[model samples]
Target chain A: MSDASQGASALTPEVKGIIGATAEKIEASFPWGIEREGLRIFTQAIMDPDPRYWDDEFAAKTKFGGIITPPIYCTYIGRRTRPGADDPITRAFEENPYSDGIQGVRTPETRGGLPNIPTPLVRTLNAGNEIEVRQYPKLGDRIFSQAKYADIKERVGKDGSRMLIVTTETVYTNQNDEVLCILRASSIRR
Target chain B: MTTAQELRDKKQTWWDDVDVGHEFPPLVIGPLTSTHLFRWSAAIENWHRIHYDQSFAVYHEGLPSVLGQGSWKQSILPRYLKDLCLPDGWPWKVSFQHRAMIVPGDTLTIWAKVTKKYQEEGLGFLDLDVGMRHYAETCPGRATIVLPIRNGKPIPYPFVPPKKLSEQTS
Candidate 1:
């Protein structure tokens, strides 16, 4: 944590100005297009044998008419992999484990995830999410996403430690620009 | 008690047959290992160390062990709910909070009990009380799903939330 002695102003005037600003060209698109296996693996990993994700015959008869990606699938599609050799995951373990890990590719031209929020503090914990789904991405559909810092608030922890609650809203859309889902995620940075 | 095999073979649930107090089969996801967390974090491209580095998670964060990713944990809710209301239903709006931490080697049961079932604008809907737990309830949340009525037309694709449900509290 860097200089929390500033109290709430630790938000830094510069960080407060960028609220509602959308990161430009920070495209979170899936070039792979939704596929059957991706759907199966996701559900299976979670131990949900929802036939709609696996059983072709069962899914064929569903309202979806066939396999459909799980609603939360879009949440995972908002990230981009690094270019060429040394993927983010591999690099995460190979380098100093104590480091901040791989640089976020979300803002390729900028530093850090969902740039413009330079809180004086580090260490963020996933608080939770409020998601309203307009639709689920279908198989063969390529998902496109853009994100923005919706809000930021400061709070004092039970221990009297100051924390910043950062909320980001990422909107997912299909190739047709039809909205697929909107995820509002909040994290506590202390 | 619900078993994995039964869940695999169980047919989709319909709004008509579901009772207000009905509890679908519980979906048990893990005695999750570090690999499980790694796979999940990898799939989502979330490189948060608390999820993968035991030392970082323990010594640094003061956690008992490497913790599970809340995003990964919450994401599984839809799969459990969908399995209970599939073929002719949709897992619509869902909200949940992490509330607590989950460590490796812990198995979590995701459960949903129908709290209410209603019809409006010629479509059927069910409000569910949902949650996840190991030794205790770690994530308590709710989901409102659209289910088909008997043989009624499939819940509209790209599901549109009925106006009546707009202001309904969870």
Candidate 2:
């Protein structure tokens, strides 16, 4: 079976049924509100040393009047918050970092934003995103995210290859219900 | 309270100082490694193996090496822009496309050039062409930023996009 046919036929009825479905509730960060320490770790991980991210005195003088997370930091805010002993996956992963580590930590929201939608497509690529920020989140702000399939369409390439373009719209909001930003991300699955 | 003038004096590029062809200083990050990828992944709780597992990415996935996440690349741009607009303005809106893929160990230099500049509803707006380049250009996109005039009011925090964008819309 060729790549094109393989992908086309793999779009089983069950898989196609998930189109237009809402993705599971996935908070981009922990529920405890954005933490100062976590913000520092993120800045350092990205090699960003902006004082505005950590220097409270300097930040207080800025227009924000407080330290602010990077505009896109909300995307990575999800951390394991106060792991509970009752959660087996969390406990198992904590007990041994390498024990089924992949399965233990992976969530349905991680792969293309919609977990396990049956598709024969073996190759998936991040196409890109259009992002709008109404406000940059601040430390101690509770960040939440909700995503849904805005659209799903199949297209044929110049080489007569078939691919699925999955577009997801995710809105990030704070506990006050003030929207932080919206990400319209599209992924190519072939 | 700290005066807006103090902030303006700290960083001095204003609406009047910019030109259509101005290019801000380039921001270079990476020569990245699995450790960098792993750290970022762990921060976000993303257990995507293709980002950190070489064997799975290469043999099983047929990739050249561990791949960098699009979000990783996307998150880095705001740092570059925020630094450029420091002391007086904010990065209002941005859009970018992952035209190409970048693997770990590639040092990415992000560059932005002003293609247009205008004022609307008392704010300075700059349209920019931005992208990441290593051995070859990987991600290319455009951004629209709102700046403050030298003696004008500072860009409001918790930025509110101009209600009237007719003069600045592209």
Candidate 3:
């Protein structure tokens, strides 16, 4: 754990300024597309024993009263890997089976899982995810989202390594533009 | 005695049943294996080699072993909270961080203890401390859920939050 100390100002005014700024891209048509089969696989993988996610008949009788996907779909909604959209990461997968892992891929890129932070601080960890749901996403509702760098702050870790905690908030909506949920995803970068 | 699974199956976790410090029945999954991780990766289309590539992860990356996906671990707590609501209630929000690395063989207990309960907008709300504990608390976070009071109206369909979505931004 090399403590690359650029001090607290490592956020470089340019970096700090990007905080609260919306990503240049407003992503639409996610890879999964919030479909039923995809959600079935996604939800069942954890084996929650939640009948709503597993049993269609039970879900239909619930308040949702229709095919509804879990709200967790909000996180993976806008990934740019829909079949052959040709993002860099997608290209990497296309060309090589043994390519580099998704190290720099997920850090700052609000869309495409491409890193967007303009700083020397590169290593990133999943700090946390905070999601507020107005609704559980129903199958067949078209999804759209806008993401912003909600906040960025610097602090020293327990081992004395300085880390920048970057938070990006993405608000998801349906094709009708009705709000669905808000996800505040925080990461530790050093 | 009424079992927790019975409540989940019947969708009957009423407001009277929850108090601060009340614990939700733990939802345990695995002694997970590589196939479990691959199934998740295939389902999500996440090809990050660390999740499934044991050679690359252990030999190249030098991780203890092929690690469980962060996304998978993160989803456990939220899913647990969501299931607690069943038919009528709603999982308003959940937040958690991956504090420890989990390898393939870890048996996970997705668990929570109610920390607070209150009524708002005629809806019953529960706030809880949640975790995915495998030997230690590997993932820890907070979750808030909305449920119906014993005999009051069921939680609104599609959930009408106390605040507007616009206000919830940031």
Candidate 4:
């Protein structure tokens, strides 16, 4: 076939090793904690004014039972303890020379102020996402995540470039085996 | 003191007499940081170190912080459409394309304009061009949504065939 396909096929072995190694590392420790403050930060960032996330009284009356976190709040549930430095995604982009153009802090021309993060990376573009929620986590709930590299493969687009497709699956759960959410995402490394 | 009832009562519906060119309400989002990025990673079960570790980000490719997830941007679209349209406005189809990255502290303004309206099979459909613009640079992403008009009935499935076929001999 083409060079891209051959390159992708050659990567299967290496990708498997990476996935297995990363899964073992993540499963061994609880990387982060889910808390109310984190919930507020995430919800406010999205500009969601739902009382369920802000007011305890209104949340109590809703079907959610109590201070229920927003559905999108699931994005911020993890905490990392080890490296004790910059965020992992940022580091991934910074290290890769090909991605430098996409990552960095930008200025808002209209507002005339510093952007929230001094440097932002548009490094990883969206390949696709699948989300299934079993139950919503309420305020004060403690949760953990099990992350693993699900699969990796390659494809050649009509443009003739070999693209590496990496798929990862993460399952979130409470102290009980009750699944909170299951997220599967794919990224393209070209 | 203003009561929650007053706040809830102030919620507007699309039926409250809307103008075609009027802009939908504006929304401010993010003073985002690595913390939020990490939380998103943990919640999404993404262990990509770039989101939480600044050193990894800077040393590796030189990013300021972990990048925001693209799916998060896509998910925000439905909510924006729901807010702009009335409760009776039901979405039939939605398509999105991510043209740029949304980092922490980016204020996004989401708005939509009713483009076309037509009646098909006793159902009313409004075509909308929905958009999200980064207030800082005016970089925006847009989508087209086919939504059902308020109080309109849904079109029935298995529409009659347009033409009759000739009888076949067994």
- TM for chain B in all models? 0.88, 0.88, 0.89, 0.65
Q: Residue A150 in model 1: shift from native, Å?
A: 4.7
What is the Cα-based lDDT of residue A162 in candidate 3? 74
In candidate 3, what are the lDDT values of residues A1-190, reduced to their tens digit?
3324543456678777777778543546553456767777877676554566556776687677776766777667554355654465655656665675464333344443323777677888877889888887777777777778889998876756677899988778887777788889888888
lDDT of each: 0.73, 0.74, 0.74, 0.49
- Model 2: runs farther than 4 Å from truth? A1-28, A79-82, A85-104, A109-125, A149-166, B1-10, B59-62, B164-170
Q: B1-170, model 1: which lDDT tens digit per residue?
A: 24445645666677889889998778787788999888777676677778888887889878898888877877777767666765557777777888767888888988999998888887888888899989988888888888778768767777777776754521
**Candidate 2: pairs in clash:** A28-A78, A29-A77, A29-A78
Complex DockQ, candidate 1:
0.48
The C-alpha TM-scores of every prediction are 0.76, 0.77, 0.83, 0.48
Question: What CAPRI grade goes to candidate 1?
Answer: acceptable
Using lDDT, rank the candidates from best to worst.
2, 3, 1, 4
List where candidate 1 sits over 4 angstroms from the true fold: A1-27, A36-40, A54-58, A80-97, A100-125, A149-166, A188-190, B1-10, B47-49, B53-62, B151-153, B163-170
Can you give the DockQ of every candidate in the order shown? 0.48, 0.42, 0.52, 0.06
Q: Give the best candidate by lDDT.
A: 2
lDDT by residue for model 3 over B132-159, one digit each (tens)?
A: 8888988888888887787787677656
Q: Model 2, range B1-170, lDDT digits (tens) per residue?
A: 12234433556568788899999878777788888998887776666678888887898779999888777888877767776777667777677887667887888899999999988778889999998999877888888887779788778767777767622431
Off by over 4 Å in 3: A1-16, A24-27, A30-33, A49-51, A54-57, A84-97, A101-120, A156-163, B1-8, B164-170
* Best by the DockQ measure: 3
What lDDT score is found at residue A92 in candidate 3?
66
What's the lDDT for residue B50 in model 2?
86
